[model samples]
Target chain A: MTSRKLGGHFLSVMTVVIAIVVFFPIFWMVLTSFKTEADAFIYPPLVVFQPTLENYNIALAQSGYFRQLVNTLAITGFSTAVALLLGVPAAYTLAFHPTKRSNFTLMWIMSTRMLPPVGVIVPLYIIFQNLDLFDTHFGMILLYTAMNLPLVIWMMHSFLSDIPYEILEASQIDGVTLIQEFRYIIVPLALPGLMATILLCFIFTWNEFFLAFNLTITKAAPLSVFIASFKTSEGLFWAKMSAAATITALPVVIAGWVSQNSLVRGLTAGAVK
Target chain B: MSTLQNSVPTTGTARPPDKSYLRQKLARPAIIYLIVLTQIPVVFTLIYSFSNWNLLRPDRTRFVAFQNFVDFFTNPDMPVIIRNTLVFSLSIVLFSLIFGMMLALLLNRQFRGRGLARTLLITPFLIMPTVSAVMWKNMLFNPAFGLISSFLVSIGGPRIDWINTYPMFSIVVIVTWEWTPFMMLILLAGLQSLSQEYIEAAQIDGAGPIEIFLYIIVPHLRRYIEIGVLLEVLFVLNIFGEIFVTTTGGPAIDTTTLTFDIYKEAFLRWNIGRSSAYGVFAVILANIVTIVFLRITRSGTQQNKEAA
Candidate 1:
């Protein structure tokens, strides 16, 4: 019994140490974000330094940071909104109305996600250039909406399906319309799941890079692009890069933390539960 | 009210005619939207893959038939690119899974500040991939003044320039760091779902901790492990941002994956036909994985239904 107690204590301490080691880089980045330029790249990597917001100031001032921030916000917000707008209704239909094609439809929607963006990017780039959608908010939003729609549909479908069909049947009457059923009954029931879906969608779109980098240049480049610009800085701008990276990553990190519980459900498509 | 009377079901079935109509209406927009924005582009890609086209030499464009694909398969660098991609993705997935499971098991135990620990652990995954790459490259992996260098010197070790010396390994480390939390989260969910009675029963039957874990826990986590691995494969196979930001596909094509190869061929080389051919292969690989993933998930769900 005593040995078991000792073992448990040992494991707990080990857990704490490993967690710190794993989390150190992010902590160091946030820490470095506040350090002076010279102090940021010291030989011993200073843990104790005069914290300064100079890096943040420099980072924010350079590279159209404000524009990128706005673009990121706009793109993430609209794409997530549109995905939910389209996904929720479709998910509702699939969950409640079991038509012959419902299973096929769900699979087809998911298959769209599996169509790697790289496969279509070349053609899409050409099309975007020809159609004047290459570097616009509308273009990014359109792409992100498609990127997020399958996720939204799958998550919302699972969430909606979990709400017992008995409740809907219990509430239904002869003359009630489908919209009324959705507006009053399903909406209230699925609100929590909807929030999770929205948060996940927002996070994915906010942090997305591949398409964002390839598709947009200057006019609509989001924060991901902003962060990528510091890639080849060759360690000269460590502090500024940290500050810029911190700014770009913080919101999504917080959102992910907040929705961590539901995140598994969304990510696994409710497979685990 | 009178029109409602006509629409309302007065027969044996309680279902309304308009409800199914509305359901179909609800489903159409998303399907149509996806077809227009996502599927149409792929069709165009297929068409472009067969034609010889270069943005730089537009006048020279013509039907290339199988030439582009032939070039892709026979390219001298094809083997190296394929090897780099396999090594990069497999190492990240395998290492992250091992470490993630260990962390998950540890976190599953009762401990102080477990929530905080989990939160801190998961933060890496939430950071933008670009940010993660730059942070690793500039702050941690730098040979001169990096934390790793500082620590190595203090410990009487050689200071290693991680990115330049071991480009593929460095990328795998960064990506694995970002992905470990993902695996942990799913595995932890699986662990939490395990019934306490099963463990107690094993203990009562004289099973040691390792034996119990090996016998009981591994089997229980098989489905979760499968789901996690498949999902990781789906994402990690197309890893780009970290590679792009860190090595730009290498010091000299050392780190180029199929996705990056396509990107370079199309954008840098202006060889659209060749890139589109590469793109087609990427699509096929993704679809193959997706089909298997869908099968497993479907069967798993069926098992869940049976168990429930």
Candidate 2:
């Protein structure tokens, strides 16, 4: 019993140590965001310093940081909403009324995701330019929606599949309209799954780097592009860069924390079975 | 596409089921839109791969049989690029799997503050990839006045130029830091779902911890491990921003993966033909990995069905 107690204590301490190591970089970024430029680059990495909002002020004032924040919010919000709008019904059909064709379509949609963005970016860039959609918010929304559609469908399909068929059949026997059935019965039963899917989609859209990096120059550039700009000018400003990064990462970090449980389920949907 | 049509044959002899129209109505728009969005670009990429189209010399564009592909294959850098890609991706996957399993095992045991530990551990995976890259490149890996340098100097050790001295290793470290938590979460979910009865029975049978882990837990978690590996490979193959920010695939192309190489060819060199060919190759490589992964998991399911 004593040996078992000692082993339990050892495991707990190790868990604490691992947690600190995993979190230190992000904590350091947040700490640096509050330090001045001199303090940020100081040798031995200042443990004691006067915290200042000057870096945040400069980053917000000079880098168009607020505009980029708004852009990030708008892009992530609209793309996730649009993906859900298109994906939920399609997933419902696949879950409830699956045929051989439906199964093929689901697999095909997922296979589309396997095509690397690099392969498709060339034609997308050309098409966006010719259509006068380059660097526009609508253009980004469309692209992000397309990018996340497969994931949304896959996740929603898995979630909806868990709903018992008898529930839907009873509703059908009661002569409910299809829309009424979906609005009344399906939505209530699958609400938690839908919420999880939305959160996952939003997180993905928010963090996407390549498409936003390649497609947008200024008008629709999100925080990903904004932070990349600091890379070229990185040597000159450490504190400001840290501040921008903190502002960019904090919201998604919070969202991710809230949805961590659902993430595993969503990611391992078909494969885990 | 043909398979889809065949599955829904349109013979006039028998009317389709009543629910078929409803199914089509709910599902067809999303399907058609995805096909259009995906197919047009793929077809265009296919066409461009065979042409001699340089953005700078548009008028010189012509169908150049297989020259672009031949050039891509023969380029001296091709071997290094391919090697770097495999090494970077595989190393990240391997290291993360190891660390993730360790962390998952630790978290699976009954412990105080387990919930908080899990949340803290997941923070790295949540940070944006670009932000993570920049933090590592500028704050952590910077040779002068960086965190590591500060620590080493204070300890009277040497200051290493991480990106220049060991570009591939540095990239693997940064990516592993970001992805380990992802693996841990998936593996933890798998661990939590394991049946306690078998484990208890093994314990009653006097099996040691190592024996139980090897004989029971490992086999049970195989599917989750495969899912983690296959998903990581899919995302890690397109690791552009991390390399782009830190090394820019240089100190002489030491870290350029296939996607980064394609980006350079198309954007920097403005050689659409060669880049498109590279893109096609990347697609083929990703498809091969995906098909293998699908077959493994499909067979696992088949075995499960047969067992039942």
Interface RMSD of each: 3.2, 4.8
lDDT of 1 by residue, B1-308 (tens): 79766765444355656765776668789999999988899898889999889999999999989898899889999999999989888898899999999999999988888998899889999999999998998888988877888899899999899999999999999999999999999999999999989999999999999999999999999989998998898899888899999999988999999889999999999899989999999999998988888898899878878999
Which ten contiguous residues of candidate 1 chain B have the minimum total lDDT?
A: B7-16
TM-score of chain B of 2: 0.89
The sequence of per-residue lDDT tens digits that candidate 2 reaches over residues B1-308 is 78655654343444335654685467777787688778789888889999989999999999998998999879999999999988999999999999999999999988789999999998888899999999998888888766887798789999998878888999899999999998998888889889889999999999999999999999988888988999889989988888888888987888999999999998888888889998999888888877777677668768967999
Model 2 lDDT at residue B21: 66
* Native-referenced TM-scores of chain A, all candidate models: 0.95, 0.94
Q: Per-residue CA lDDT of candidate 2, range A1-273, in tens?
A: 999899999999999898998899888889988998888877766878999999888878865788889899999999888888888889988888787787568767887877799988888888989999899999999888887788888888888888998998887666555666776788889898888888888888999899999899888999998887766664557888989999899888888888887888666545652
Candidates in order, TM-scores: namely: 0.95, 0.94
Q: List TM-scores of chain B, every candidate.
A: 0.93, 0.89
Off by over 4 Å in 2: B1-20, B299-308
**Model 2 error, position B24 (Å):** 4.7
Interface RMSD of 1: 3.2
Docking quality category of candidate 2 according to DockQ thresholds: acceptable
RMSD of 2: 6.0
